[model samples]
Target: MNSRRDLLKTVGAGMLLKLIPVGAFAADLVKFVDVRLWPADEYTRVTLEHAGAIKYKHFLIENPWRMVIDLLDMRLDTTLKDLTSRLQADDPFVQQIRVAQYDANTVRLVFDLKTEVKPEIFTIEPIAEYKNRFVVDFYPKYPNDPLLALLQKEDPMLREDEISRALRLAEAETNGTLKLESGSAGSAPNTEVAKTEPNAPVNSKPKFEVRRMITVAIDPGHGGEDPGAIGKGGTYEKNVVLAISKRLKTEIDKMPGMRAMLTRNGDFFVPLNTRVKKARSVNADLFVSVHADAFIRPTAGGSSVYVLSERGATSTAAKWIANKENASDLIGGVNIKGTDAQLAKVLLDLSTTAQINDSLKLGDAVLGNLGKVNRLHKPRVEQAGFAVLRAPDIPSILIETAFISNPAEEKQLTNAAHQQKLAEAIAKGIANYFAKNPPVARTPLT
Candidate 1:
């Protein structure tokens, strides 16, 4: 009788298991890890990090202009409670952020906006040092135009002084008198004139004693979420390139008929597509992406230059490197599901050959100068399908300053002296390119 009863109970349990759905008893916990806010001229991003996949619904509220984000099946943790504190008072878009546990298993965030904005809210898969993330990006409805921003009406008297200060700023860096460096961008420039050119080209039918300012977009590869390649000494590639790029910008601004615009002025993550967009948006004459390379073997040392290849990568190594760099969108995290028509233009507009040819010329010019300052990784510029170099019209090139993998080279890469030398070399190379190949103005895109 007992054996019969045990068999019946086992059969009944098996029948009940078949009727139940899968994951019915899974853990009902969603751990909120941290919150980060990055405010920039382009956009302000709010990132909510969590351990597991988070379900969220975000909606915009009008009248007062606010954004409401509701997280489902989640517990508001201490880290996320600190979200309000992460907001800066000077944020261009957000006035304030309010957070609360709206109800059981639901957390809500309300962003009080100063103006109307187009919000892009999405979830990103775990990458690099980050886990599951929910991202909220706020872009102004009538976004500020980069070209307009680049062209500001300045008091004619201050223009000459600005150039002079830029010229002396480079020397000041070495002399330790660069009191107003990258951090002091808004301070009045020194009016002391080191020198001035007598005959500068006045472009676009300008009759005044002024010259056309050719914008060179200097891009420092990788930042924020993407730390980029790291050295054994704990040096980050992003920081090194940023330092060099800033020096290069200072040198360029000092020259007549030239101005340098940075894709990023701070240590914030600008998506790979966004970098190219920023350059093109400013109608930049040239695009130079600066980076420091790394290899598995610590023996690799020296610098290299790269141009986009219309076909495929010119070498096996180039292919591998290009593939790795193209994966930045993954590591940096992009809204893969959302359709970005502008970003997806795909460079299939033809005329890619002319762009690549011009890029090669620029690469050769930069490579020649870089060789003088550092050991050459290759005697010739390598060709690869670098995504960052895919601007349809703008001449673009990527420069690997040196191999951060090699210990000796890594030490040199991190040194301020070497950084300045590298910047000077690159600036000279750019000046050389413009000298031989003057940019032809094209009708602005509609």
Candidate 2:
């Protein structure tokens, strides 16, 4: 015979099991509703919907394109064909559409494109007068013939190989399997000014061949149990950034002399300290931390870049932003005291005043290249005490791709084509920076 206590316990266990949605245990809980490229003469709109409560919105806009996605707290139960058919045959802006499940809780909608375009994404929460919204907007750019050839020949396999090597390094270091250095071996260099000469059938000396490959660590922000930010459209910052990071990796792989590694590839949560550890372990030359900004104002519609903060935040606005970004661990339920205190102290002490200076220079170079491809929030790079940017040696920058809080920008961020453009711009910025500032090679033991 069962006692009252036993029955109660059994009932409670059943209730708990019921509470855990089937989607949670399954690898991917989210489903795709519809992903379509709705084009207007002025801009193109790419929309997404899924199951779940409203968490957040995201916008990714570099130059010549934009992407926005609304994250819902609900699950999806739609088919890919159902959504793809919505794209009209007459639409000229979007080149193609691709949709697939990213994970148990997320779906990816990719938009292929014919050309680059400037873009923005944002989310609007219900206010006294307005309803909730996730929006994306676009700003067209003039054609660049050189860009076409570059995109056509892009490769994803080579990029993944580099990323795999870096990940192994990161994992080894995180698990105490590897010890690394923070010295400045190969600092970015300056470029010689170009001069034009008359072409009089002079047999030009064959262009000097230089082979340089850079190892970069690309962190997709939040992941696993830690949803970085909750958007008005129920989008999780972790899932969204991861998708973008993977796309960025694909493009980076396509390049000839560059490779990228992700900090955390799946839904597992990673501590702030661990992020930098991974970058340093792999001897990453540059660290680009990708994120979608969220704010009280839904109207904020531009991307911002940040290097490490030397003296904390200089202003109230900076402080606020820092606080929000730092809160990511809280959502992910991190045991900071248990894992990071010692490493934090060591990294800070080892992170000499000079490393910060190098980081700033790297930020400037990347930002300058970014400006060439996208609309920037400010002409100068912003500084904030971002934990993700704490690597003592790596030249690191955190990019707020765009605001997920603004409705117009949010729509653009979900568009696959725009995401590709954003990826291209970032890649281009990195390439340009490296071209001018080639890395010094380490001598091998004879």
Candidate 3:
């Protein structure tokens, strides 16, 4: 009894329903830019413009070197050749340029060294007072300069996978497996601090077990403008970690005797020092940083936990985590060239021994807890000097939840239920640590 038009409309709607796939609308194609190297002293001048191609102001700094190219939401579409040609033809100090696509969202333009130099990479986001702009880092690379050496050593570029390797090396040292040390390592400026250890005995428990509300700091590494590790499918390390961190926080909050605070609340940048400061601000009982591992090869898998190591990364994973953590400074706004090299090195040296010891204990507890929920890389802990875990007094552990670079594991990491399991495991670890070795009561919670 239906009219011809109504019958055709009903059939068309049914056909459309059959053609559509579930969640088909949720996917977006990933876009990326290419990168290549260029010669310096090529571009005498560089300029940036707004969305409509309106010219914006720009400037360049010769010493403590960098280039500031300001723009208003300008989509940078120039090829690497264009960049190289500009630099080779005009720029004075730049010997050559090396460009790499850090991710879909960022590009790294390395200015090769013609002389001893320092550089900083930073950016200002669109705010009420200012507009979004990109800053170029080009500095002289000093050879064997002590302060530069220290910074370079801590610099993610120098020590890749430092955290994972350092932890494994630390474990190896404890196990008497490997006694690896670099030639210049012992000669480092703060030799005394490196040699000193906490007076607390390995077996000694806290003197007084006073019940208190223990606050734990959880730092989910890399966010916003900085994505820690990129996977094959374009799943961002920042997004994955924030998910895990939130899950961990939820689990921690449900626990009766403890509380957890995150280094960051949303998709924004948080510095390594600021993350440590957040733990101190909360008077944290412990600090545990969560991260996903990435590697040059996709074969890397398994979970690893790390503590601080002054020497270098003890294992492969430790090295990767340290490298990843150190890059945050470049993205976060600290000009390595501007920092007092001696002071930074000294602070790092002083914190190494104590942080290493505390990191071991913390690592053991977390590793033990993770074992109950999922498979571990090994039964022992690893060591590495991850900048984020460099809090002087607070015991800090950096846990590589899993290697997101590995395809199979990336699937597991992206799963919500798996993330819940991982979070639950970490929370249980924190709870168990407190139960066994209760922290001495400090100030009351705010």
Candidate 2's C-alpha runs over 4 A off are 1-212, 441-446
Give the distance in Å from residue 281's predicted Cα in candidate 1 to where it truly belongs: 2.3
Candidate 1 lDDT, tens digit per residue, 354-418? 88889999999999999999999889999998988988888999998997888998899889999
Q: Between candidates 1 and 3, name the one with more favorable TM-score.
A: 1
Among all candidates shown, the one with the greatest TM-score: 1
After TM-score superposition, the amount by which residue 423's alpha carbon in candidate 1 deviates from its true location, in angstroms, is 0.8
* Best-first order by lDDT: 1, 3, 2
Please give the lDDT score for candidate 1: 0.80
Clashes of 1: 0
Q: Which ten residues in a row have the lowest lDDT in candidate 2?
A: 188-197
Off by over 4 Å in 1: 1-29, 153-210, 337-339, 443-446
Residue 202, model 2, lDDT: 31
Pairwise lDDT winner, candidates 1 and 3 = 1
